[model samples]
Target: MHIAFVSLETVHHRDTETNRRLRTICELLRDAGHDVHVFCAPHWGGDHPQFEQDGITYHAIAESTDARSGVAFRLPIALARAKPDVIHVTATPPGQVAPAAVGAMLARTPLVLEWYGDGGVFPHRWRRWAAGRADRLHVPSELVATWIREQGLSGDSIETVPNPIDLERIRSVDPGEEVDVVYARRLDEGANLESLFLGLAELRRKDWTATVIGDGPEREAYEQLASDLRIRDRITFRGECSREERIAVYRGAHVFAQTAEHCVFPTEMCWALASGCVGIVEYHVDSSAHELVEGLDRGFRTTSEAELADAIVEAGDLERLDYDETFAEYDRSEILDRYLVQYRTLQDEQGLL
Candidate 1:
């Protein structure tokens, strides 16, 4: 199958979660022996019409990245010429979606828009229209799916597909230094690190060390809080670790705590769970982190510092593992299969299968 991905700005232009997700999907399809083509504004040096990297071809739709109108005008023609079986686009810069819709119609292809719930400065109405334009809309979680429905789209139009992770890497990397607890996220105000810090403070009498992975503006304040709790020495702050570095810590640690006030999807929590860490997630009204661990034996959901602390202690009684195969379902290959299933369903609906 030949899949055409439409995005005005890609990971090369801006390293956003949505862009990364788009790139990952394209590469997954490419590796699975499917023809993958990405139509976007030029990012490579020079005025090249097309650039091939990692077995996927990127077609430059516009010369300048800021030329939104130019991209909108040219994308449909480019995609029509490519004549892909399916057209996949990100739900950002909502302007791109309308043009992609035209392209899909011109090429007689099924249009699928993936809404990660992250969009640039665009009108709410534009987002709604973008939602309406797709034959099938994909979201990362049920939370985002609810948002999509609120846009007045039918339930059948929206599908929830999660971000993929590399499980093989989790099994290959050696565990880092042994630790009792692990917490990871950008150390921002929304991080809500105080929950974990206060919980750890309650267990001051216990002999356990933790590793905090990530860096941000709130790092200093969090460190001060840890010091005030007098457990600063027991916590190691490894700032902004690479994926491999984080997997090492998650594999070595016994429990992974997530206290973020808001999370569209608890990706790190998923990673930690896949790496064999007992997940301890603090329930928040806006956070969807609990979705990953709810009703699972390997997870504990808490509402307060006391509960969090107790959950941590209880996690120790559970069996310790270096790697959990249960999460293999979220691996890239598995995610690719889920996507392929959707593509085939769309094709069959369009009488192209």
Candidate 2:
């Protein structure tokens, strides 16, 4: 089947969860023998002529193109020409959904919306309307589906799929090297980084060295807080390392500690667990991250700093398990099959079969 992805944002232009998922989906579909085409606007710091990468082909709409606006002008024409069975779009840019809905309407094809199950920030009004425009919708979690259904979308119209784990070349390295805790996430708004920071301070007071491996809007604030907490000397801030570096750090460390205040992060942390690090989650009542690691791996969910710190230390000696067996369900090939099921479902509903 011909499947075209309409994304207003460029991939390399931004380092974000959305970009990573979209790129992974497109490439996986391409590998599965589907004809995948992409339409994107200019990247944040990049303004280059249109080009394709890997197996996916891309077209830059225009110099001043907005992803939302790109749909009205470029998308319908492309969809009419390429004639895909379905057009899957990310639930962002707030503007892309409307135009793409209309394009699919004109082509009489299905439009499916994709997003992380974070109680999507998109308006219920828009999501409901977007659902009406498309034959179906896709979300990464049941938690998100509940939120969208509350906004008037029918639960039957939505399918839940797990987010893709961006796999890197992981080598099986010895896991008993050091007793360290590693935190890797953007220190930005909405990211509850302080939980990890203060937790780090609590550990370092006991003479442990915590590694912080990312930077963002709250970088300086976190840095200052580390100094104020008197744990600055015990932390190593390796600002923005490449994917390889992150995997290497995971292999060398004994534990991977992730506690993002009020955000769901188990999907990313699962990669760390799969790579053989004992995972540690700072427990919170509403944290869906806890649910991801409960039964399959070596992650600990704790309610207090003492319990958390103790868990970190305990992770070092625990026998490392092969999470590859657990997470293999989310591998590129598996995700593609789930997607193909969605496409076939849409086709069946529209009587295209």
Candidate 3:
């Protein structure tokens, strides 16, 4: 089978969870004996318009200042050239839907749009209409699927495929020296890091230390907040770590704290849990972290700042359990197999098989 993946950018240049997942899926599919091709803007180097890495081909679509329009204009030409059996597109904003839908149509290929369920902004009616043009939709969680239905898309066309976790890489690391707590996420406004800082201030009575891992626009403000709270001495802000560094931090921490206002299966938190850190999430209206850790023994969901502090304290006393059993369903192999099934099903339905 030939599969074409359309995205604006991928992990080939940027270090984001979405791009990393896209790279992983492409590699896995190629490993399974499928011909995989990626159609993306030339994010890394300008020298090569096309290149091959890890048995998958990447075709660089010319980029313009207006990237959305640029990709929309160029993707159909690339799709026609690749002539893939199926088209899989990553839809971040609803705008990408137009190019992907049109490109797949031009190629006469079945289209599957994977929605990461981030970006709290809702799509405009026209964007939703463009999305409705796809043959099927793949979302990371049921919450997202529900949102899609509310937008008037058929529920039957939506499939919930959780992001894949590389358990093998997580399992290879040994637990480092222990720390009291760890918070890993973008330090942006939506992350609600101030709440975590306040919760940490409450833990002053207990001898505890925290490591905040991640960088974003709010880093300076968050650091200043820690100072104002006088907990700055006890907290270390390690901005944007490498993959190994992140895993090491998770391995060293006793508690993993999440206070995001909205999350769709946070990959960092999952890595923390898989690294044996006890999970604690501050409940938000649309958070999926609660769902991920709900039934697990080493997980806690807090509704208030007080509860978050208490959960952090409670987590310190708990022994780290083997998350392999708890997170088995998210194994990369299993996720790849699920995608293969979906691909085959769509192909058969369209009589392309």
Q: What are the models' TM-scores?
A: 0.95, 0.82, 0.87
In terms of lDDT, the poorest run of 10 residues in model 3 is 118-127
In each prediction, how many residue pairs overlap at the backbone (N, C-alpha, C within less than 3 A)? Answer: 0, 1, 0
Looking at model 2, the pairs that clash are 68-96
Q: How many Å off is the CA of 296 in candidate 1?
A: 0.3
Rank list by TM-score: 1, 3, 2
lDDT of 1 by residue, 122-143 (tens): 2556556766868999888887
Candidate 3: residue pairs that collide: none
Number of the predicted model whose lDDT against the real structure is largest: 1
The lDDT of model 2 is: 0.70
Candidate 1, position 201, lDDT: 96
lDDT of each: 0.88, 0.70, 0.80
**Better TM-score candidate (2, 3):** 3
Per-residue lDDT, model 3, residue 74, is 82
